[model samples]
Structures are given as structure tokens and as C-alpha cells.
Target: MTSTLGFAILAVLARGDRTGYDLATAMRRPIGYFWTAGHSQIHAELQKLRSADLVGFESEHGPGPQGRKVYHLTDAGMRALRDWVTEPPRERPERDELVLKTYASWLAEPDLIREMFADQLAAHEARLAEYEHHEASFDEPPAFGDPRFGNYATLRCGLSYERHRADWCRWMLAQLGRSGERPIGR
Candidate 1:
């Protein structure tokens, strides 16, 4: 199944009845930054799911909007989600343009590379602050403290990634200084 199909299945099962727009909004809140599906993509995927009998839709009654379609996951959809979850994922291919660019330009312009690392460090710190804000305000906070937190595993993973980036940046900056290069961005 495609990523969009998997997302549609999960969205519908999480909430019993949701319009296409509602599903898009739901995706944006928790997983949008990670998954990044457009509204048109979601609508198209929903149509495909309906055609495959993996989902069902119903018209709303006494609604301000006439004949809005609310979608729900079928039994088949639930089973599909279960099967996908259990299946081992394929290896993800690495393709980071920023890293490539940094390494490519490093020999010619080491100072520029140092500046790039410094910039990345700032960006990572900003992201960590944003994650901390979400952890505090989100209805479901990260599992750092609370035992009942359901998404703690994923949250911890994100925190670890951010920490790694921050640490790497620090090490890179120290190496720059040790080399006696006129500090980056000077």
C-alpha cells in the first residue's frame, strides 16, 4: 500500500467519521511535518480507498454544508493497517542535499562549511525549543515524565535525534577552532 493509503486508513480508524478536509487537518497536526501529504493527494487516496472497498462514506444530515461526505474505515481497512504495521519496512535510501553540498564545498571553502555547521546548530536548537513547547502544550505530552503517555517512544526518538545534531555541531565547531582557521562568519 502507498503511504497515502496507509495514512488514510489510520486517520479514519483514529476518528470514526471525518470529512476529507477533516482528515487533512488531522494529518497536519501530528504527522504533517513528517509525512507531508497535500489535500489533493488525500482526496485522491480516499477515492481509491473507497473503490477498493477499504473505506466507506456517508452523507451528513442536518448539516450547514449540504451533502458533506464523512469517511470511516471498513473492516478491510483495519486489517490492511494491521498487516502493514506487522510487515518489515524496506531500507530507506539516504539523499541529503545539504550534507552533500557541505562536503562538496568543504575542500575549496572550509570557512563556508564551518558557517554552514554553525547555521545548522542554530536551526537544531530552534527545533528543540519548538519540540519542548509542543511537549508542554500538546494534549498528549512526550513520555519524558508521564507514564501514561502513549507517544513517548516516538517523542524520545525525536529528542535523541535533536541531541545528536546539537552534539555533532559542537564537535564540528571545536574542530574549526583547533585548525586555527579564522572563525566562521568572522
Candidate 2:
């Protein structure tokens, strides 16, 4: 079966053909914001898609990509991508390290936990600021069917998620300060 990464490769190809290097650049930008895959992982997935008959490629003839493959979606790949687009996404298991830390935080000093959350909040805020700048750069959202529409929509979601995370961190900080939270003795 084609993996989710395979579909990601196909999705990129749907926009247009690209060499592995170009695809890596695209992945690092908007897609990397969500679905992260390393350069090697993307290449491996491309090979898998080729084996599955989901993608095709021509010999690349660019500077970096000299003699490399410029991959493109096959008809079957397009059909599979369209079908996957509408189907509900599978639920990924929640494995956030900070959330896990939060679960066991009572075992650590409250101040240390506060520091961690503070750092997290700052990171989230920084990303939020960048996303905001990007959103402002767009004169308007792309109309549906534009590939840019996908980028805009995902940025909006990232905005919401960052705000929510920052708010939660603030709440945690407040609780840490009040009532003089004490860590449980080991």
C-alpha cells in the first residue's frame, strides 16, 4: 500500500513536476510546517510511489539535478490523491513531549516546569508572528481551486493552533505562580 508520505509526494507532483531537490524545498516551506519528511525520506517515498505505479519521472537536466529524475504524478496517482483528499484523515496518536512532561510535572520542580513552558510559549509566539506576517503579505485569500488556497488555509490553522498553545502556556504559568505549587517528593 502507498504510504501517507507517498500521497504527500503525489500531492506535490499534482502542482507540477519537480526534481527531488525542488520537492525538498517545497516540503521545507508550507508542507514542512505540518508534514515533515527529510530529503532521504522523500526520495525513498518517491521510489515507493514509482514501484506502486503512482508516479513517473523524466531524466532531470538542471544544475543540481543533472541526470536525476524529475518526478510527476501518474493518472493513478492523481486519482488516489483526489480520493484521499476527501476521505477523513486517520487519527495520529498524540505523542507531544511537552504534553507528556506536563503529565509528570508534579515530580519536577514547579519552577523548572514553568521555565520549560515559558520557552515553549516563546517559540510558539515567534512562529505565530511569522505566520501573521505571511498572512498580512497576502492581499487576499486565493479563491478555491488555487493551489495557494491550500497554503492559506493551513496557515490559518497554524495561527489558531499557536494562539491556543500560547494561551495554554500562559494559563500554566499563572497556575504555577499562584498557590505556590510544590513538586511531590520523590
Candidate 3:
């Protein structure tokens, strides 16, 4: 079975052939599970995908000491990606630390909790602003077949999430203010 990282690599190649460095940089972006990966993990996945016959690379002369390899999806890789795109994704369990903290927050000091939520609200608003600015750059949404369409689509979801999260943070702060006594935990 192909791993998600394997598919992430293929997706980047689907846009165009890229060196491993390019693929690593692309993975550090607007969406997806690969963001936490370092360059070594990305390079390892590329080799695994190559071994699985999903990707092929060409040796190139470059300034780097070992030179570079430009990777592209094979026909099988393209076909696999097309099939995977339509299939329902395997859902990973949601493990949100903030929500967990909120559940346990009644034990903490209300002032400190308010400070934390306020910081969180600010962060969400900042991210929302950045995504909105990027969305505004396009005259309209890119058409579905265009590679940019995927980027635009993911960005829309991010904007919505940030808005909701910021709203929730505000609500939490308001609820905390309604109480006269401080919470128990620090």
C-alpha cells in the first residue's frame, strides 16, 4: 500500500517534475499532513516511492556536491493518484490539544486562561488575514482543471476554519468573564 507521503510526493510531481529539494519545499505549504517532515524524511519517502515503482528520477549536473535528481511520476504513479483522489480518505483521530486544555481549564486560573485564549484568538485572526490576502490576489477562483485550483480550494477551507476558531475563542473568553470567582487550576 502506498503511504500518504508517497502520494504527497506524487502530487508534487503531478504539478511538474521537481528535484527532491523542490518537493521538500512544496510540502511545507498551505495544506496536508506532510508539513512536520524534515528534508531527510522527505528524501526517504522519495526513495521508497521509487522502490515501489511510482516515481522515476533523472540524474542532473548541478552545483551541489552529489548533484541532484529530478523526480517525476510514472504512468503507474499517475494512474494510482487518479484512483486515490476519488477514494474516501482514511480518517485519522482528531487530537486537538486546545480543546483538551479547555475541558480541563476549569481547574486553572481564569485570568491566565483568558490570556491563553486571547493569544490563540490573535493567532487565528492573523492566519485568517494572511489567507484572505492570498485569496484576494486572484481575480476569481482558478478553474478546476488548473493546478492552482487545488491550492485555492484548500485555502478556502483554511480561511473558514480560522474564522470559526477565532469566533470560538471569543466566546470562551466571554463565558469566563461571566463568573465572579477565579477557576481552581493554574
* Candidate order (TM-score): 2, 3, 1
RMSD of each: 4.9, 1.7, 2.2
Over 4 Å off in model 1, which ranges? 4-12, 61-66, 137-150, 180-186
lDDT of 2 by residue, 79-116 (tens): 99999999998898988898899888889888898899
Give the winner by lDDT: 1 or 3: 3
The model with the greater TM-score, 1 or 3, is 3
Top-lDDT structure, candidate number: 2
What TM-score quantifies how close candidate 1 is to the native fold? 0.73
Residue lDDT tens for model 3, 57-131: 999998968878999999999999999999999998989999999999888878889999999999999988988
lDDT of 3: 0.86
Q: Which candidate's TM-score is highest?
A: 2
| Residue 160 displacement (Å), model 3 | 0.6
lDDT tens digits, residue span 85-175, model 1? 6678768888877667756644546677778889999998887777666667656544544533534454456667778888888888788
What's the TM-score of each model vs. the native? 0.73, 0.93, 0.91
| Candidate 2's TM-score | 0.93
Q: At residue 111, what lDDT does model 1 achieve?
A: 73
